[model samples]
Target: MDDSSPPEPTGDGHYERLSLPGSEFSPLDALVALVRERGLFVLVAGGVVLLGTAYALAAPSRYTATSTVVREAQSEPEGIPSTLPSIPGLNIDPGNAGRTGLAPSAYPNLLTSREVRLAVARDTFYFPETGRRTTFVKHVNQSPGAVELLIDYTVRLPWTLMEGLGRLFRDADRRLGASGARSPLLAPSEEEQRALDALEKKVSASTQGTGALGGESGLMVVSTTAADPTLAARLNASFIEHLRRRVREIRTQNTMEHLKFVRQRLAEAGRELERAEDSLAQFLERNRSVIAGGGAPTLSFRRDRLQRQVRFKEQLYGQLQKKLTQTRLRLQRQQPVITVAEQPTPPPEPSAPNRSLIIVLSVLLGGAAGAAAVYFRSVLASAEAQESGREKLEEIRGSLTAEEIVQGVREELGRT
Candidate 1:
């Protein structure tokens, strides 16, 4: 027997004797032995593979629908607002006001907003096999109420208890640490709160990925997966319509406010002009009796001064009036910043369940799981072998060690 070989169990089991072969077992040889001798292991692995294949076949198909939205950066006409004060004069080229363009970053929040979600939920329809028209929310709610009830009960009771248990487990850190004292968990910070809020919005929006469909053209892509393709198309179209309506309403409100301001200024200027004319008339009427000796020069100078004043006031009033008109026109037109670049069409093919991809993924996952099961079984078998050997050693040696014998005697005496 070679000294380097593992021991073989003796029949009495008091001590084992080792027997070594002339050549040592290589890694490749041991692996081959494990595979050949462990027929159960291979059978278990084959069973796992078969089970995984069954699961993949039994799994329901899932579909993904995608939509795209493009950002339209509408440039406000230049010089309209800048020439506001000089509307009556052509000398000054009034430039356009610096209007703030909507940022793309804002679109994620906008698309995921509660208002948009609710609008989609309300407008989207689902056609059942029965050919009945059902809104999206209604369809979701139509599922067996028992499932919802069970979920509610679980959330209301065990969920809260589990959270408390989690806190207790986490508190174990204090016992292991030097401080021994535990700090209370604090509420989330403002930034954390904002992040949570954004997360909630994103979840509600259900937007799948970073891909957006539309570019600069006010076109939006709205897509939804439903049992009926026609219903899905209609839902997308309705969502777009609602979005447009909301945008129009916002634009109209802004335009109206601007128009109101312009009209107010126009009214004030008109009142001031009237007051100036009334004052000039009153002054001339009172001074009608007082004629100068050099009537031509005095009258010409007075007339020139009054005419210049009136002309200046008239120009100011005219500019204000023009601004008021333009504002009103803009309010009426209410041009939308976003235009529909592409209208949704009924999709001929379902966007979801890419069968080829699903099958490929299923096979890969099944293979990986099968491999893992094989490895875990090998480890468990090794552990069992070590445990069995230790038990056999204990059983063969009935005599206790000094400390164990003393403790056993003491325990027996105490019981007596």
Candidate 2:
């Protein structure tokens, strides 16, 4: 029962573990064990650290550029006060009282939408790597570096094999009279799609300080990442520009159509008014003496009818003129104005691949891995010293297979 005595071996092919109090545990023994296997520990730890350092140096640098914008917030109009007496002819449009323009909350989604991305993809940018200005599509489809090519081929190996097999089967089926379906008309070409995908991954948007109690704050930040700092800044700026254009178009689309309609009607009304005036003038001139003489009741009646028609046309034209003015005002009000709070500038330093942090984490991880390996080796050696433990260990080694090891690795990666 002495504190330094080892625990007795149990019948279950394991040593008995005593439930010692916290004060009885000593860290010095663990330190001594690690020092005893210093050679193995240094080999594992040093190798891991070297690999991490190499990765830190070899990884590509990424720069993130950001632009901030503040959108004008529209609030609902107040209803008529109870103290004010309602007028019989005065009317208020309920639709006009509420916000009809683009909402601030939708800025992030709009920036990330397919339309904006496609528009950005069509823009030309300067790529430092190629030392030439080219469209985004061409840049995305450019030749890959040796390392990139290797990674791309390795990652896509399974998919490539599957696709080949699929084509073979499909050809056989075609010979058996199974026809393939037609491709969709709206699908994009492979090059264009690659550019769009690249934009989707690199460009992003977020909102900040959205009002108290879940209200919209109207502040937005758009960001883009690229290998080159200037390119990153350019991409960020392009996203903001296209996003503004799209927002304005969507906000004023209905109002612009309405304005066009109103103008057409106003023009028609003016023509109708002019025709009525001409008919009245001609009728008066043709029967000037007769009208002055008041001799023919029929002629006087015709003059009166023509005069009334002219007055009616004048009134219609006036109403349409007022409607045209009101529509112009509404269109102006519905237009969205995005104010740029902060312009994107070329980043002075890379925003990714923090080498120092990577090195620190690598060191910690390597040391921990080394410690675990040392402890496991010691325990394993002790277990092999006994007859029952040797037999049990042999059984375990015999039971393990390559397939199970691969499955276990896959499961661990999935969890990670």
Candidate 3:
């Protein structure tokens, strides 16, 4: 074979190899590769491990309370259930939503709605970091839970740097806001808005369906997170109460509206009937002789007309009264669709800030750093060795004969 060509493997698994490139680096090889930077690598990797440990220690624990609910059909509701249009992301399956109509799917979203959340805030008390308990609607901010605390730790320095830069841009607009120039864009007042935002984040409503929104069954979950376990449980319970009340409102709103309109019509019909009867009575009193005279032309025509109007009004009144009764029955027969499947209980343990996993990941991170360092050094060494070998080959070629080069190759192959 030519000197530049690769040799084929011999039958005994030996070959006259001409070149070797360091294609693979095993774990042990990685360790031995970066001998010169071992101290630096140790320091950096150890620092990463220490940082992770500190983060695990510093992160606060948070409790989660959960309430379960199920979607159910009303007992033989007449007409269509009011499909109060759901918020965009609330019901995942828009196409399948109309199968039973909007009412069933809307129950889940009713829990997370702005109205329900606002009402919950008004009911609850807010305890700030350094103050006494005040009405949540006045000024409310609950510190973020464990997950947020962990994220804070992870991105603390970088976030601080970014925050400073952001301030440079937003400082003027903030001053304008502080001065009472109401920003046209924001709907809620600052205090109310903050409370809503906090409550929104703390509350989570999830359903058991594989639909676009996921969680489809009658099964649903309502959860709340707070620093105090009891508070979390209480919030969840309160939210559920609001949800039930809202469900009742939605269920009866249509019927009640129809009932109100029917009652108005019934009253109007009664008044018209009374007026018609009174007019007929007065006309008879003025012309009592005409009916007794039985063929007074003017009296007969006037009396017949008045009698017919009175009869029509009476019939209309009866119809409206019947409609009123039916509407009331429709409202009364419909019971609460959403029932409490499971009540919220105080969670005994914090669900977040997985200390064990955090530590394990920290160690793995350190190991990864060490591996990277080793690979970096190995590449540099390989480049330097290649350059040195190239220089040596040039020197050898200039000084040695072809026979020497061939003999040296044979010897090297034999030794291998």
Candidate rank order under TM-score? 2, 3, 1
| Local accuracy of candidate 1 as per-residue lDDT tens digits, 1-416 | 64554545578753231111226635554454345435544555556555555545543343223455554654445444434554553332334322233443344456555565565655545465545676555554454467446654663468656745655654564344535443322333223333333324223223223435334333344455454566555655655566656656656676666666666767766777787777667656765655333355675577567667667677878876776666565555545554444555566775545655656665566555554554554444444457664576565465467766777798889952
lDDT of 3 by residue, 4-105 (tens): 344476898754222324554454444444444576578778988999998898776778999887776655446633333332212223223213344556
lDDT of 2 by residue, 1-416 (tens): 76566556678755432222235545764575577678779988988898789878878899999988886664422332212232222243323422245677888998998788888888999999889999998988888888777755775578657756765665566456534653322344557666776789898887786565135656788889999999999999999999888887775676676677767877877888899999999998899997798799999989899998888778777766665666666555543467788999999999999999889988998999898877777667656767877899997886588876777788889952
TM-score of 3: 0.61
- Can you list the residue pairs that collide in candidate 2? none
lDDT on C-alpha atoms for all candidate structures: 0.52, 0.75, 0.69
TM-score pick, better of 1 and 2: 2
Candidate 2, lDDT over the whole model: 0.75
Estimate the lDDT of model 1.
0.52
Count: clashes, candidate 3: 7
**Candidate 1: regions farther than 4 A off:** 1-100, 103-109, 129-131, 143-223, 291-309, 334-342, 354-363, 380-416
Q: What TM-score do all the candidates reach, one by one?
A: 0.59, 0.66, 0.61
**Model 3, poorest ten-residue lDDT window?**
89-98
Candidate 2 has a TM-score of: 0.66
